[model samples]
Target: MPGPIWTSPAPPGNPAARRAPPAGRFRSWWNSCCKGRAEPSRHTGGIVAPERVDFYVLNQADDASRLGYACMIAAKAWRQGHRVYMQVDTPGEAEALDRMLWEYQAASFIPHARTGTPEAALSPVLIGTECAPEKWRGMLVSLTRALPEGAAECRRVADLIADSQDHRAAGRERFRAYRAMGVEPGTHEIRL
Candidate 1:
């Protein structure tokens, strides 16, 4: 089991909730994690890059485009045989994503369910408001301003930045947070 990670938001004025664990302590958890994953590497990582992370820079900041791209990304990953969890900030976003995934492509559909449902465990993709569920930690596509919880345990985390001032600011904060978590995140520009 892994020690507690500050993956979610604490109510305002709760300083401890916002504070992250020390670097050495966090690294220790990653090294000793027994999640049936491959043998631990002697180096400061595993088979993949340390907490592999990627940020997608979007040209348009509109909700439609953001959800569309997220749907596409989730579909591609699912087709490639990787389970994905789409983390949204609230129940409304979760519902929006669930509906968008269904109608994203007229010729195809992406199988998915909300986090608490029975189908979520077996579905290739899951959309949820929370982020710490062990089963949904394979790959995370976060559509929230704050980084989702349990991100350190995920094999890969995909964050998005829409073309808006607020989005950019939030993206910068997450970029810095990822660095603090010992990950050198990769970046990609989405033309559409």
Candidate 2:
């Protein structure tokens, strides 16, 4: 079965009055939701939740370079003991990423499988063109133009943005989407 679709409650002070609870309340609620498996936050004394979204702006305009960085990010996250979901825009891109992950670095190995594969459930990293994994609630790395579905359930989300005008525009739109979801995503300017 598919996971639930998460949407942010409307902001406070709106006429609709459908806002989410205050941050403190939300944190407590999240802790209760995670119950025994919650990780404590480093910045806050509360439990860690799916509130952090990061936008990476790459200096290169080539898609290959962007994908290389995605591989690097995925490998790093995997080494840190975090499962990852790498969402691409198309099946061709997903296949290309699956091939590249094996040879992206000379010394690094990121154990991964594409979505729907029998091994995907056991892999530390998963790559797919559509539909986020239902059980692996970890980091999400989006190489697509739009934000991947089910990102609200991830511990963290990374949107890879190329350094072209069009790409930047699309990234901005995604940034707005994150904000709309009540997450103020951090921005990182990458030199590569």
Candidate 3:
């Protein structure tokens, strides 16, 4: 089993709970209609704005470690009423993500098309996109930097996967050459 990513929970208890209940009495009520758009200004006065939280999971192949981190981030974001999205390049990648989301019990999975080609899958991938009025980018930067050893682990796993793909490609090329020469490609022998 893996440990959690974020340490603490959202503050002020419940976000919705912090909202000021409808003002009581006719004086507070009397303020409405008499003033120009007072209700909208009062509600939108930046006093009770929703805290913005966004989690972006970058491009990933079959590496479960990266997905696990994403799951943790997503779970935290969901708890805070923030929108969560994942960028999936392929059906297989999307399915792997589905399994990760299932494991983490995230609120939702939104698929997105990756800009690069399949070959790019072996490279480092950035997943999530954060947009908010204040410090959202800074938050993401800090979160990524704070990734205890996640980036290193993710890089190692990605390297192993890329190496395997290269090996498979080389084997396919060798087999093709054999077929071109009208000879059997033959099976590979494994030694103990």
C-alpha lDDT values of all predictions: 0.77, 0.76, 0.33
- By TM-score, the better pick of 1 and 2 is 1
* Runs in model 2 lying further than 4 Å from the true structure: 1-49
Note the residue pairs that clash in candidate 2: 10-19
lDDT of 3 at 186: 35
Candidate 1 TM-score, C-alpha based:
0.75
lDDT of 2 by residue, 27-145 (tens): 32122222122454443335343557789999999989898999988877777667778999999999999989988988867899999899998998899887576655567789988
Q: State TM-scores per candidate.
A: 0.75, 0.73, 0.27
Best candidate (score: TM-score)? 1
Q: Write the per-residue lDDT of candidate 3 for residues 85-111, one digit (tens) a residue.
A: 344334565566556665554455433
Which 10 residues in a row give candidate 3 its minimum summed lDDT? 152-161
Cα deviation in Å at residue 18, candidate 1?
Answer: 43
lDDT of 1 by residue, 1-192 (tens): 996555545544577666745444434212322232343323335432235688999999798899999998788778766678889899998888999998999999889999879887788788988864676566788899987776766767788889999999999998998787668898999999
Error of 1 at 49 (Å): 8.8
